[model samples]
Target: MSLSSSVEFPARFSYACFRLTPHSVYAINATILPQKCRLSTILTAPSFDELFPDALVNPSRPSDLHSDPFWAPTLSVDLSDASGIWIHLGKAPAAQCDKLLINVYKEYSNDSSRVSFLETLEVKCPETAVKWENQRAGKYLLTAYVPIRGCKFLCDSADKHCRQCLRTHLSLEIRENRASFIWLALHTMKDHSYEIFIISAVLVGLIMLVMCMGMVYALWKQRRDAKRVQEIQLTMYVKAMLIYADDCVEHRNCMRMLVECLRHCATCEPVFDMEKLLQPDSVIPSRWLIDQIATLPKFIIVISECGSRILDTTESRTHHLVQARPFADLFGPAMEMIIRDATHNLIASKRKYCIVRLPYSPEVPANLAVLNFPVFNLPDQFGQLTAFLHDFENIDQLNISQPLSQSRMTSFREAVRLQMTFFEQNPDWLDTRWRPIDEPAIPQIREQRLPVEISTDEDRIAAAKLYGIDPPRADSEDEETGVGPSNERQFMLHPPANEPDSDTDDDDLSTSEDEIDDEDEEGGEMHTVVFRPDNLF
Candidate 1:
């Protein structure tokens, strides 16, 4: 039958029915015919129910009549060309097609009849022939029909064919033209999620960076403060060492270490050059010693008594070395003379010079007097030693002869006066002078000339005046006691014999008392008194 022909099928349609299995279904329905048709026409009609079934039919009623007016109306003109339609069915329904023929027609009158009906039967029963001929051909062909200009249908027994067909068509459409929209949606979601991730990552990184920077800065500041403290401590230690270098020659190691610390300190802070302190050619040691003493710092000289004795021996050697040099000329005359006298006294008396003692004691032995001048102490001694060094250092520039000519004599006399003054001020020193017993007395000598032959009164007067006495008198009370004007001047002015010679004896006793009084006034006591007589022949 031509696919486009509308046909009416007999209501007495019948066919061998097959049971529906779980995988298949069967559909049978009816529709009102709009035209008269013959049996041949029924045979020639396309499978209209398969091709165009109303989708509103109840799903539970596989065989119920579809009575809704919409279902009863003649199928509308085929819309296959305007909207493509597909149908699907499973196996079991095709074997029951003969009992389920349906009539499909259009609602139109003959007044406008331009259509013609023609019938011709052609059976494409290849599957039926193979089944009957072989009886073992298990594969079966379900019938399918399609109007030339209408929808397609399958006559298999599957009940979900329509849904399957619709699903397949939708899948095809999605695959063909909607792919870009789906991809765009997916990319947008990914972009949003990525943006959030990046923002979070950046925030976390910034926070960590800030924390790390803060930690680094704090550590740097701590180290800086520690370094500053160390520098201050080092500077103070060096200053202390410098001050102690005086009077503590054993602290040379401490001073050297302090200098080393100062060198290191200068690396981290502002300090003077420390290398100058250690220069071999410099007088830094001596200068530093002087400076240390000037600062009023004390050095502890820990001398055991035994050590003191050894030091004394060493000091003697040092003095001998000092004296053997010509540097004494650099000292003032007073100091020079005193040093010379002290040396002479030491040699003559075979006594140790107290000045040569190492570690001068505050009080010396009574026999060994300490010079009370400042120059006798260690500081002044060092000053003199340094002065000698200065002179030695500039020996070429000194004019020895010029100083001797201009000031040496005056300085020598002044030095004598100084010694006298020192002795006078300290009588204890003079009292210690050694004296000898049996000291020889001064002799009295007589004039060899004939006692000036005082034969005249002028001569007698001259002799009396020369001797610091009164002139002899003749016939005076002086002659009544057998006193004579003799050439001997002693008896000439003798006390009157009548006075019992008490004046002469008393005068001699008074002179001896005056001598003793004078000795007492000079701050010395005579251990023994000696008598001397002025005698006459």
Candidate 2:
């Protein structure tokens, strides 16, 4: 479409200009009024309010003189920090920051006064290029740091805040892309924002201080409670017992030996045979076990790798001489005791029962596998068993505990002799007689005297007395060769390692007690009793 205009009026001089671009011909009209309008109406000025009503978002801080109406808040800042304050300007279409300007006003009543010259404080805008990554992540613009260090000029010392603050106004400007002059923009302004920030900062500071005090008090209380609980746990009169599968021969033997260790070496007095605790009329073995468990404060349950199989054994213990109730019948009560104890903390606030895994049986039984008082892994946390028992007695007393005395050693030997007698009772248990593999029935190898043979009657009596067993009588085997059943433990001593095997056919090459004694005196090597298989029949 073409138009012949007879009137000579400059389109730029009239506010009501009528025109449209090539794309706008069908979609838009650049002008707002009809073409047949009068010159008065065409030349009339347009109200900035009518053009952009929402442009004055904040009336107190209007756009700067050269700023576009739409580009109202071109400057942004975080004035909360008093020490280091910075003023930022939005990037131009060309992304140029060379013509940037910043000013700090001391006391400007309203924001419209920055246009003219005023008393400006000395400020520095350090030009630094920001990396593209930081610009994107931080939503950064053309950054010109107006380093308002200290901000001393903005101080109102009356109400102390952020080392005393005074509100100051700042403005920023950049070279305009389309317009001939540079664009001026005021910083984003809000009244009492600093006041709110100061108030919030004070409140936060108080809250943090109170929280720190509360944490300190809580820690102190926890430590005090723990100390009190420990004191309650340790006492002078601590009666503890040892428990294990009665069907497990290894467990029974370990417990029998452990009783002596506890009596002499350990801090607490160990109770092994609970049969004495049974009532005269009580027939149920479970009841006796339950009663013992209920009355006892501390218990050491011996669990070996094969303990699970022991629990599963329907028959009585294989090699043990003494038998009362089936192990299966007795273990149920013990399991019940474990379950009841683990469900809740004790009055002292810690688990009392300990699962003892000796070196012989390192693995824990499946029934006692997942205990709150867990079976500590071997070589690592295994000492918790002894630690628990130690808790039963006075810690100071345990620290000053002395080794077993001579009399106590005699008692220990007595206990060990009882175990040895029990070991010898099971005839099938000990394979002392060795026969040739080929010859089913050959002449038996006569038992040789011990390396330190029973030589004198007094030595025999002393040895018997040392083991807490009765000495043999004068008419018995005690006088013949001073070798008898009373001092049988010494017979378990291993012969010399280099001594020939007695399977040969030579009687002159026999070893007598005198020769053995001479050989023992000659060689300084110790004659250890081989300690007899730990009472394990």
Q: What TM-scores do the predictions have?
A: 0.15, 0.30
Off by over 4 Å in 1: 1-252, 260-537
The best candidate in terms of TM-score: 2
TM-score of 1: 0.15
lDDT, candidate 2, 5-109, per-residue tens: 343543453553444221111111133466743221101112223222343444565546343332111334422222333333433232222333334332233
lDDT of 1 at 11: 34
Give all candidates' CA lDDT scores. 0.31, 0.42
Position 537, candidate 1: lDDT: 11
Cα-based lDDT at residue 363, candidate 1: 35
What clash pairs does model 2 have? 154-166
Which candidate achieves the best lDDT against the true structure? Answer: 2
